[model samples]
Target: MNYDVFNGDADGIIALLQWRFADPLETQLVTGVKRDIKLVEQVEVQAGDELAIFDVSMEKNMSALEQALAQGAHVFYADHHRSGTIPSHGNLDAHIDLDANTCTALIVDKLLKGRFHTWAITAAYGDNLIAKADELADKAGLDAGQKAQLKELGTLINYNGYGSKVDDLHFHPADLYQALKQYVSPFDAIADNASPYYQLQSAYQQDMNAAQAVPAVHESSKLKLFVLPNNAASRRISGVYGNWLANQNPDSAHAVLTENADGTYTVSLRAPLSNKQGAVAVCGQFSMGGGREAAAGINALSKDDLAAFIDAVETYYA
Candidate 1:
């Protein structure tokens, strides 16, 4: 059996899409909400099975990866997250890059020699490597109109992954992947009015309208904090909203907190775009928190620690 395990975000989805597009395969897809990075543990592999993992931290899935290797499964892994230590296993082929500007889709793009270059650029945009994506788009000679199309498509695909659960998402990641696979180029999807691109555009605007209407809960030169009510719209918009906030105030760190059922908060933190450093470090201070330097998140933060988290952000950026 062949299994393709990846995160549900645009980067993960596009990375796998590039691989499957270049080398078509019938495989079982294992994915979940964007935050569910431990997808490798969910698969039951046997000797001789093939596993391809993408955009998920190997550190979080280390034990499951070891189990799969021990069971004789051949695994191909690629990601840009904090991978604590890579295990040496003949059955594992790991391609990981921790560069601040690199993502798994870009890694695959390099390996495939840009066989699906446009799709790779979209993933880069989705991952918030905006300047890098723009550079690549310019190098490819894409016009302003084309670049904007890719950016919106990428952003919408990314926004679709922000929901707290698959139930909150407009389409399951697997379904969205399937829907998008029909297009050899992302522009084709945009050209099709009935495509997921248009659907997501409408949905995203509605959600953003609601999110933008809410004022910031706290603001300062060092950091800006916003607390959102616990609801599907809030959950769906939090991460993208953080991205928006960071871009709007490039010199200040931004945090978007969504109230959780248990009175905790789901936190998304973005370091100042002017200095994309210490976000992962700040988030790492809390349990259920880990991400790249530019963007990080805490899965569940106690309401009691909210003030402390704000203090930490302010201190770090101060």
Candidate 2:
């Protein structure tokens, strides 16, 4: 058996696609939302099985992975996350590069040496490394219009991974992967498979427009909190909405919280461009971890901690 675990986002899916294209193999997939880093532990591996892991941090799931390795499974890991320490094992092969600008899609691109450069460019755009994507797009001889389409597709795919659950996504990552499997490149997908691509893009724009209509619940000189209803639509739009708010209000740190089915809150944090420093620090106090200096997310937070979280942000800004 071959098992492939990846993050449920454009970069992860593209990475998986590149691997599959390079070496056509039947593999079971394990994935979740963008922030779900512990996907490797969700599967049970048996002896002689092969596991290919991508886009998830080894540091976060090292123990479970080590257990699988010890059980005699051969593991191949590729990620750009912060890897703490790799276990010394003969059966394990890890390709981890932690450069902030590097994503799993680029890793696969390097490994495959541009076998699927177009897909790699889409993943880079999804990761918000637009300059890198643009460079690759130029090398691939894509025009501005084509590059914009790829970037939008990448952004839409990335946005689809924002919500707390599968219900909130425009399309489940697995289903999206199936849709991509039929097309050779993202450009080809847009050109040939117009229905799925345009359908998702249309839905994404609708969600963004809806999110723009919601008024901010609280705003001060330095911080703003945008509270969204616990609807599937709101959840789908949360991250992109938060990003829009951050860019629109560059002086105010933005936190977008959507009520979840369990009554807890799913939070998306965006540090204002002016500061770009407090979100991780504040969310860290609440035990949520993320990076990118300008953006991050917390999977869940109790309603009880809302006050403290607000206070922390206020204090940080003060």
Candidate 2, 131-229: lDDT as tens digits: 678898998899999999999888888788776678778677878877788787787788875646788788888888877788888789878898788
RMSD of each: 0.8, 2.7
Off by over 4 Å in 1: none
TM-score of each: 0.98, 0.87
| Model 2: ten consecutive residues of lowest lDDT | 287-296
lDDT of 2 at 39: 89
Q: RMSD of candidate 2 to the true fold?
A: 2.7
lDDT of 1 at 28: 96
TM-score of decoy 1: 0.98
Residue clash pairs of candidate 2? none
lDDT of 1 by residue, 1-318 (tens): 999998888999999999999989999999988998889999998999999999999888999999999999999999999888899989989999998888999999999999999999999988888889999999999999999899888888888898778999998999999899989899899999989998899999999999898888899999989888989999988888888888898999999999989999999999998998899899999999999888999999998899899999999988
Enumerate residue pairs that collide in model 1: none
